[model samples]
Target: MKENQHLVHHDATTKTRHGQPSTSPTSIVFNAQPFGGGPGATLTAVMPYLRSRLKSLGPIALHYVGSSLTMDFQKLTETKWDGIHNVDLYTNPEIGKRKLVSLLQHLKPQLVVTAMDELVAAAAQAAGIPVVIIDLLLWFWPSISPNWRQAELVIAAEFYGVQERIISENLNNVATVPPLGPPARTTQDPSADVLLNFGGMINPLMPKQEYIAYSHLIYSAARRAIELRNAALPESQHAKLIVLVASFDVAQGIDPKDPEAARMVLPDEALKLMASSELTFCTAGLGNLYAAGAVANAVLLLPPLHEGHAIQTHLIQKAGVPVDAIEWHELTGRAPIDYYRDSLQVMDNVSKAQSEVIDSPQAQTALVGRMLAAMLRSASAGVSAEDPPLRTLIKEFGQDNGDAMAVQIMDVLEKVR
Candidate 1:
């Protein structure tokens, strides 16, 4: 694990503090999806487990590859990471890949661990670095990329259609892991009645104005729904809603002191808060759904915020899961299921699939109605089952396999070491 001083300074927001590069004997690079916080959160959650397993190697260098779109890199600041490389893959893929490859070549790491960032993993493999790709969205990949086929290992989160896709792809190197998210709470007391968490509320390809509108629509609807629900209860029994966002862009211009306004926090802190909440209302992201479901007592999914979100929301509903979802049709009046599939064709563009809803005058009104309905249903239904729908989601999708993934990475590192 030798470092090149010049490469260390190449657009690195976080770097080792040594006056001279150390000559550590082993190194690893952890790269995560630049767009969403979920992939990065999974990678970070696995690090502690991986780190403990690799401690015998004695001071191995850890490098993180991330982007500005997410707060993933911030979570690694307190960890034993030596360098953080922030690249702009969305604005310029070729240049980002070049920078990434150059960094990998300089570090010459023993292994590369990536979560949903196929391009980064591919860059590493092209540079002769062993790669581990974490497919958090394994449930919905219609086709496999050649880049994935070449990876040293693929750790996939198990879901309904996951095994079928893996079998179809003939991916011998793949390992089916459980749903990944924030670890469960041990002794935390319930803090909020309902938590409104919208994970990584930005898509690079989506227009900023459109995202602003979308975020506000969801936030306002959720807040109003909770308010209406609370109005029906005794003053002491009123349910509280706390809006959590990774960026202020999701809910801007509100007093930070306002309990109902959005408050920006790190991924881990947000999950910790989720564990203490009675109910979690979030977007239909695989990572978000799993993390919230695994920890919170009750979980209800909000509508699709992106194309990938649209697919996952539809799949969850199709699977006949008992969890409630504010579907795309309710908000957009676009029930043509094929529309979601067609959106997948242009999925690479990564824009909002429900443009009709975003542009509609009644979008916010519809969301309010749906959210209030869901809240009222939950309040009236009370606790019905021993194992809730959230648990059902966890049973259907695999359990948290962060530790298993860490062990696998450690095994690879041990072989190389």
Candidate 2:
């Protein structure tokens, strides 16, 4: 994890680790940020990895955001720890005040892990919880991004950017966080399946019928492709595609090895899978983006509904997001049901929810099928001999060898006195 020379600006009165050392094994409560109204992969993926590494210090509590915590996050919280609590954060600060405050008091955390969620930070500070904010994968968010970019102190992924503007703007507070992703990759099987993941954007969408129809469409197209390929080549020589839709346990014909695997995938296992990938088709999320980059040499980034993703990808490309290695396309629509529903029959809700784009399931299926076809074609041919070395990624995210991030966290935490 490299850093810009001007990243950390120390005051005469404060030093990261020079001050009266805080007690060893200081407890912490990680904020389960629910920003942008979505389920948290950070909790399921990033935090667990951090927690395992950080446990040597002291007990850690996980504070989820929302009235109710379910899904993968809840399952993660079920793991034994110092504490496991849910609170209404960001979206409902006032609503969560009492609950959050009580939990902080109970856990007595020296640090409240925050991901540029100022609302949560402010609340924690108010409750006497020292806050350490970090940027998982986004920068230049219209409201939150710019502020974190300017914070007197914060951690960010170096690949996202040098934050050169911030350096020139303030000569101060910053730290470099290595690309947070899966574990290191082992040997990649040449026959490994191509990995396809769209994260939460694909699951628990609406109108079961529409989703099923779309699934059928994708399966038919893939089967057709397979049939044609087998017609020309032996069955053993056909391209293998491993599609992971977290929401759909059973795919029409695109069945994943395990639907629940996304929530429970081990870092080491995840890295190996990605490494074996011939190509990856996934959404632009902080966790998955970096994970995909860690292993896959080739990638196809699908746009999520949020404009924030656009901002993140565009800005990071300046530093070293491997934009040169990535092939960006906008041929398909958004990956949600609200939008996926557009490709379905003309229902009143669909008309009311929609305006211009005919975002029906059929259109999405058609586009996704074509996208899959493109990916499969690439997989069938095999990785290029001259494709730019994945060195850019090696620089951007560092090696996926182990939980080295834990050591980095220790470096920062010991100084949080």
Candidate 3:
């Protein structure tokens, strides 16, 4: 049967002596953009795992496409690439498309891997290269929608157990990979206190009343946690309550240079202040989650998103992190004051739940290894490698601590099944 050619574009020169255009048996190019927020941090944290995965592919040239605004990609570019192109595709899809088309024509990658960016995928498919779409979050945007039927494969984090069902129903090829925990950070004492952090661009459609209400809810929740801790513990032993608000530099309906508009938005100094706190209270977004995970335990207060909020929430909770559900109404009203008064009870419940499921570091490393293995296996299958030895590659990358991490990942996978 002819493959579904709609999703990928192919060159007229169909046959090559080697797997790819060059002498190399197989070549894959990864097109990843910088994640703007918590998801970005999650992606950044998983870089080690990704690097390990790339190593498993054996001297394959990996090209990461990203914006110039973030410097994180600088270290990645030091490695030799068949080619490297940096452009703000997310901000300017038209220019991105033109540049990406040029890259595909020049690189002729056998496989292209990306998070769901439809324009890039469509272009790759138009070039006849197989595309793999990783849906990092549960939500789907109409603008950059995935055409699963056209994609060679689709991979999603295991936190979205339902995704397998969704994909099976909608797409021909699909796989579910477990959440590889955030990349390791410098060790520090996990803060004993509760921390809160929230982020996202304020919705322009959201009325001024709505923003005020949301801020009020957060304030009330923080105040309540404080009251509960103080009342439950002796004044000396009470845990500190810290609130960090990581606001987007962009504001709704505001001019960039307007001081008054800037004042209306949350300040950078405020975010720094919040980061310094022991605990963070914030809505569920990638930036806030990573910041919390990077520094301390968090009390994740998820805000509603049109899509993917539930999946994101599940991943956060599954990581053995503490989280609480505060209704939009509660946040908008002063009722959170009373809620915080009862926070000691709520926090205790969350803490207990977190302790039971938090995977050990060894387990996390193994999970990371497994995810890389799966991606490599998929890539190998597409390129028709003869039983490639990925295990050895993983060990070479220093992930062979033991089968403990793999065992833990399998256990989680089974539970999801």
| TM-scores for every candidate against the unseen true structure | 0.85, 0.65, 0.49
lDDT of 3 by residue, 278-381 (tens): 34455655444433443322233444331233335554457444455433222232222212223344333332322221223442233223323322232222
Q: How accurate is candidate 3 locally (lDDT)?
A: 0.42
Tens digits of per-residue lDDT, candidate 2, 1-417, equal 332122121101111222223443455665545432123444444555676676565544344333222233344333333334445553455756766666567556666766556666776777755566666543443334444543335666555444654465453566665665554343334553555554443322234444333344344444454455445665666655555543332233233543432333433454565677666655566555656555665666653334344445555576544542221132234332232233223233332323212345555445555555555565565546543334355455574322443455556666774
Worst 10-residue lDDT window for candidate 1 reads: 344-353
The top-ranked prediction according to TM-score is 1
Stronger candidate by lDDT (1 vs 3)? 1
- Clash count list over all predictions: 2, 11, 27
- The true-versus-predicted C-alpha distance at residue 73 of model 2, in Å, is 3.8
Put down candidate 1 lDDT per residue, 177-211, tens digits, no spaces. 77776544332345437888877766666556766
Candidate with more favorable, higher lDDT: 1 or 2: 1
lDDT for every model? Answer: 0.69, 0.47, 0.42
